[model samples]
Target: KTTNMPERPFDSENARKKQHAEQSNNELDENSPTNNNEQSGDEEDDDENQIKGNEEEDYQEDDDEETPDFTDDEYGSEFTDDYLCPELMAERPQEHESLNNVIIVDNLPKVDPAKLEKLKEVISKVYNKFGVCRNVYYPLDKDGKTKGYGFFEFQNEQMALEAVKQTDGYRLDKNHTFSVTLMSEFERLTQVPSEATDIGNLLSWLTEPDAVDQFAVQSDDPKKTMIYSNALSQPILLEERSKWTETDFVWSPKGTYLASFHEKGIALWGGKEFRQVQRFAHTGGVQHIDFSPCERYLVTTSARPGNSEAFIIWDVITGQKKRSFPVEQGSPYFK
Candidate 1:
């Protein structure tokens, strides 16, 4: 017991100091600077995370404010009501000229060579009478024959109207009658001379040649006429005749051909040479004729009293009938 107790001998100051040291160590552990630093760092990290979350929320709000909605009524209302009707929206020209610059002559009978020259002379006289010197175009048919009607353009409306008034119903050839009127407005725009002031003058200039020849008037048979020319210093006379028996003829697009109808057939002639290049026979008289714009085909109407009306389309090249249709009484001009 003495040996075991002898090792436990400790000084009072040493034991007390050891106990104080232990207490000091416990106090230091409770309030260490390293722990305080770790706590402060955690608080700083939380603050930084909260600030970042607020910034993210602000950015999302900004993005939502920028989008546009198309379903609103203000977007497309004005564009739909303006351009729908084209005709009403069309703008008319500010300056408009009179329609009297264009001249249309109707109701002319087929003329032979002698009467053709006379008709040319009469047209010249008419132009001279009006004191205009514009060009006149007399388009002929495929047979070198004049379509009964032609157009004359003047330099101005006054001149054109003068020609119309002077020449309408004015006789040039014995059996031919003429009707003159202002051309339609559309025709005036397309065919009248751009700078012409007098169409009658222009026509007069076209027919004046260096020489004149004379030949006998062919016949009064109302079907045959003779024409003579001596421009080449030699007298030449040719008999002019038309196979058509009906009135109201039209010229081809180029004014180089004539289309006409007759009691028995339809005929087309080239203007330069009086040769019949096309002919279509019909059981009845051919009353009307019209050519397509492209000149690929022609339509003819055959109507006789007490008989059913019929229409035929013929190939321009071969003069062969391509189609036929029957028409009722008082039907339209074209079926």
Candidate 2:
């Protein structure tokens, strides 16, 4: 081999490295900042065009879509305006009649609780001579003494007017004289200013921004009952009364009336003062009562004499008896 060998090209590491360096430099020039910017601009333009094309397709699809028909269908008919917005269709405000049949007797003799019944009897005897006395009420003081003032309810406005005329300034004894006046007249004399009427509105609580709810509570004491406004912080008492009911109290279906139980009858109370609105005389003594759905009538049941249960239906507004049926002790309707 040492004698005369032909010349051959040999592969070297340095030669390969030089060739790779040249190719790398050429690639760097092609990907310089100026050229990269142009490529990126073209890609951005293509993306914007694709977005616009998608938006146009979506618009066309939306335009071709049909609106749903809901008229006369089960769901549509069932959810009419009256059903969706029931409050707008609510009944009108209830009629609040005058309290003409009630009279206030002032300047009476303040007496102890022991003599209160006797005093009421004496007052009743004097007033009954003019007309039938439906009810007599004497407000009491914290010390259980009479307040020297009373309310007398008569059969009608005419009877109340007569009682006021006959008893006004009439001397009951050497110490006390009757200063009788119609409740309506007294109200007129002591009427609050127009701006102050809001203070006496029973429904004013409904305007509270918090939209608080209210509930009534009957105390362990049969005669005590309280109305409370339920608030987030605590329950606030709106009104409370002792001797408001003899045994139990109930609210009307619409929460417009409060019915109080008593041995003589059921007394319906409402309005700002919670005064007596009507009286249903159930002489047999009411044990249970129910209001008609419309609140226009009341049904009261009592244990009558001779071991029978008496059910009486009454017209709520007129306080007149509608019908009466007696169930014997063993009858199916006895309870």
Candidate 3:
């Protein structure tokens, strides 16, 4: 029981060989070219796939960037229908000739060449307050003098309109007043009206076939005023109008005009159709009217409240008021 079996001798040489062999096999496995080649091939394949995937993603991004996005915010909803398809678009309309940006200033003071620049400076100073003046053109006479009128071009139509409205009838001096108008209106005003061609001679009524004297009558009904030829057998109606006269009517001394009284003033009617030939504007009501013996002048009397000038003398043919007289404390209303 006490005798120990001889301990197995440690096999140092055999153990060392086995361990060395195992370490060599392991190193060989790690350093083998075939195994390394397979591992590297797998890595290469993965890299190629990764690169291809990146290239495909870049191509997709390029395609997205190249495609046009026709959105409402960028091109508008009607761009395709109105601009792209030319046949679907309507033809552009022609623009009318307008002088909307040009103004005509008349009644300016005429100046010689020496003072022309000074006058222009003065005019520009006045209009520059309203808007920027693009150009100022004053026509020159043969003697190199500035005309009394000029053309002003403004930056826009609104400036021209404001200039015309504010400066029309503007008094620059005691003797000079501005007659401002749009160039467009100047063109229209220069052309005569179409009705001017249709106007017949004023003395056509004097040539009646029977030499019958024509007389106008105001009926009891306010609307029924009539003119008649004083025929020998019967009164022949010539023309009639409703509410022609307000209070009274008169005939010119030579029967050249049939005058009708109106609250504003008097209306002179003549010719074959008894058309209105002229009108006089008296602010207050006209109570009495008298024509000169020769029918060359008309005198109108009005009793205007708080107004001293109640008498107006008008040139009949020209329809221009020649003079006005103020009422005195004890003087008669009319002379």
Question: Would you estimate the TM-scores of all the predictions?
Answer: 0.29, 0.37, 0.45
Candidate 3, 1-335: lDDT as tens digits: 59877755677778889999999999998789988998999999999999999999999999888556666476566556556767645654222223788889999999999999899889888899889888889999999988799999888889989999999999999989999998877766797654542447777866778888888888876567999889999999988888888888989888888888887899998878888888899877788788899999998888666556588899987788899886665433544
Query: lDDT (CA) for every model shown?
Result: 0.65, 0.81, 0.83
Best by lDDT: 3
Model 1, position 6, has a per-residue lDDT of 45
Model 2, span 1-335: residue lDDT tens? 47876645554677788999999998998799988999999999999999999999999999999866766366466567768778875653222213688889999999999999899888888889878787788999999999999998787889989988988999989999888888778766686644422224445556789988777898874567998879999998988998788788888887768899999889987765676778888876788899988899998888666634388889997777889877666422333
lDDT by residue (1-335, candidate 1, tens digit) is 35454444567778999999999998897689987898899999999999999999999999889565688888655664335655654553222232456676776666665577766776666666665636566767776677787676667777777787788888766876787777654464457434522213212212537635333243435754444455566767644564243544566654445665566777765423445656788767777777788888888777655554488888987666798877667643864
lDDT of 1 at 203: 20
Lowest-sum lDDT 10-residue window in model 1: 196-205
Give the poorly placed runs of model 2, Cα more than 4 Å off.
1-208, 221-223, 307-309, 331-335
Clash totals in order: 32, 0, 0
User: Residue 39 in candidate 2 has what lDDT?
Assistant: 94
Ranking of all predicted structures according to lDDT, beginning with the best and ending with the worst: 3, 2, 1
Q: Model 3: how far is 300 from its true place, Å?
A: 0.9
Better of 1 and 2 by lDDT: 2
By lDDT, is 2 or 3 better? 3
Off by over 4 Å in 1: 1-221, 224-239, 242-248, 305-309
